[model samples]
Target: MATDQHLTEHTTAREELLKGHVLHVVRDTVRLPDGASATREYVLHPGAVAIVPLLDDGRIVLERQYRHPTRQVHVEIPAGKLDAGEGALACGQRELLEETGYVAREWAYAFTMYPTVAYSDEAIEIWFARGLEHRGARLDEGEFLDVIAATPEEFLGWVREGKVNDAKTLASALWIQNVLAGTWKLDWQAPPDQP
Candidate 1:
């Protein structure tokens, strides 16, 4: 790959467009690598975490929820935006329990993904979890979804059929597939005590 300095854009000025409850929009004037000035607008996200919870029976937890933007029900791994100053692993554990009522004894850092590079700075950190014990889900106010379990084969089949097409979920499928095939590995750990 070429050096980044040759391709980097330097921000000269910035303007706030909209500050929504969850999204912060901004436009910036930048000097391109070729010394050309341009305007760029993008969303500033707080980042998020996604969990691939594995069960002893060889199944993984998933969710079916209707997203307003897409206006379609999506099958996704448990995920949520990070709380202010929250760590990736902490957010993952919190989301898994709050959404699926499952707690894992073992956790592993899988990978991170940027779903939208051109229009948003949203990063989702993905984690793998196992040794699950179901207590009860404590969904946040105004949150509703159906929790389901699927085997790796079934999930991959959905991916091929275009049923599971959400970017974050798809990215996770890639990692999970490789991990199952022994092409990738994860460092599993026990959960730390909550503060």
Candidate 2:
């Protein structure tokens, strides 16, 4: 509501730490509001989108894949990073079709979340999709995962049992619960015409 200048930190200098194929790391010297200088190290991400694909039978589409960083198989929503110059909805559609093989007739924007606010500038745009038509999955090279469908109750149960622990997925669970209960409303729309 009010201005946040009191809590702002102005960057004094920046240094590139690492530039990888997927991750760009940087360090910045900042002048805090209290007149103190400090260094902040974080990853500059290309941003991403996660899709909560819903079925006519009230089930949700999900992926079971082994994440190398966590060294575990996680049950998560279909998601992928944005390509150069890609919009959030476009990324969501592409990822949903590419990862799960089902394209939706209706779509809605849920919300955006920063998975690791302290260390990564990675903002994930969450979307909702329904009226799905299955074509086939087009997995990227070296990418492997299993697509599964679950009822909301079953999925939430897995979450309660500590099975679905992905940050983005957890955030989507909150949205899904609220939306199902009619507490949160979504403005559903038709997919844009393809080129």
Candidate 3:
């Protein structure tokens, strides 16, 4: 394997082969450790964001939706694809409100991960939310889902029972549990905790 410094030193620039509405396929020029050079293609995406909005007592707000691509209904955290150049915090906040009709004052980043790094370059950032107030959903024209609130116990049961199926949301849920337990630090400063 090549080191970061070696890779950076030999790489000149990245160029694109395909630029679609959602992603750009690019070829990165790099030199190997053995003095060999090659170009590798990678899909570049704008990334996405999700939120695990929690009630003061630690109940998590989740949503159930039919994921046509998977041919199954997914119980997932409120999430959405990011708009071009949108901030992760903003996307998480908007997805929480738009999908679940809840607004939160306290927002803490929980985790950042790539959903699929192989064929796709999609990444997700999860946020933990508190101090929520009920609002109205502003869903997309084509969106459809049922909003539900679940405690970690209930949601984990769903996972164990094979109900919670979306990979990104499941990973977010597991990681958010640690955030609730005060284990990790998110980049964003959370608002004061409140019911």
Candidate 4:
């Protein structure tokens, strides 16, 4: 049987305005079975996408770049913010090209992430990309990075060794393993990749 970890009891205690980006305040004052109540405030974000582009021989492509917010260079799956109204796969393809300068023969939307529900609305759609061939990057202004290739086993090992710590990348990499092993599924009506 599948285990259900959903919280059984919880209610909003209060909300405060700390900053603006889609309501920056949140409170979790609702009591639990153990009589515990706590309040937490977190940031809100629109959402994004992550692409795990894989090579026919099992290698996965990653990008190393500086995240201005963290002020650290981190290796992550190719990803980007949604356009004014761009679909996930479209955005994923664009990001794959812009960040890694590569294209895939096939790609599939794998899953999604809420980052932290208690914190923000930054959900991200993860894509599993394959059939890769180099195409060269189309970097936008002020962007810089290098493409690094690692095998799937190496990628997962990196996660275990604390090298690939990006949440979306980790989750999507695991999902790719599952999907390739026939244990994962796609939505019945997944939106088609934008041309």
Q: Which regions of candidate 2 deviate over 4 angstroms?
A: none
Error of 2 at 58 (Å): 0.4
Candidate 4's residue-wise lDDT over 1-195, tens digit each?
865445565665766556564345554466664667765556656578898887788788888888777888887888888876877778888888888877777777677888677567688988877767677788989888888998878877888898877777777777867876779874423235423
Q: Per-residue lDDT for 1-195 in model 1, tens only?
A: 778998899999999999989889999999999999999999999999999999999898999999999999999999999999998888888899999999899999998899999999999999999999998998999999999999999999999999998999999998989988989999999977421
- Candidate 1: give the clashing pairs: none
Worst 10 residues of 3 by lDDT: 186-195
Per-residue lDDT, model 2, residue 15, is: 100
1-195, model 3: which lDDT tens digit per residue? Answer: 865765452665688899987568998887776678787788887788888888877788888899777888778888878886877777877787788888887787777888777557788887778888888888989899999888888888888897887888778756766666778665546643322
Tell me the tens digit of each residue's lDDT in model 2 across 1-195: 999999999999999999999989999999999999999999999999999999999999999999999999999999999999999989988899899999899999999999999999999999999999998998999999999999999999999999999999999999999998899999999977531
TM-score of each: 0.97, 0.97, 0.79, 0.73
Model 4, residue 46: distance off in Å is 2.3
In candidate 3, stretches whose alpha carbon ends up further than 4 angstroms from where it belongs are 1-18, 27-30, 37-39, 182-195
Q: List the residue pairs that clash in candidate 2.
A: none
Ranking by TM-score: 2, 1, 3, 4
Candidate 4 residue 113 C-alpha distance from true site, Å = 0.7
Clashing pairs in 4: none
The better candidate by TM-score, 2 or 4, is 2
Count clashing residue pairs in model 1: 0
For every candidate in turn, the CA RMSD to the true structure comes to 1.3, 1.1, 3.9, 4.5
Ranking by lDDT: 2, 1, 3, 4
lDDT over C-alpha atoms for residue 180 of model 3: 60
Q: Model 2 — TM-score against the truth?
A: 0.97
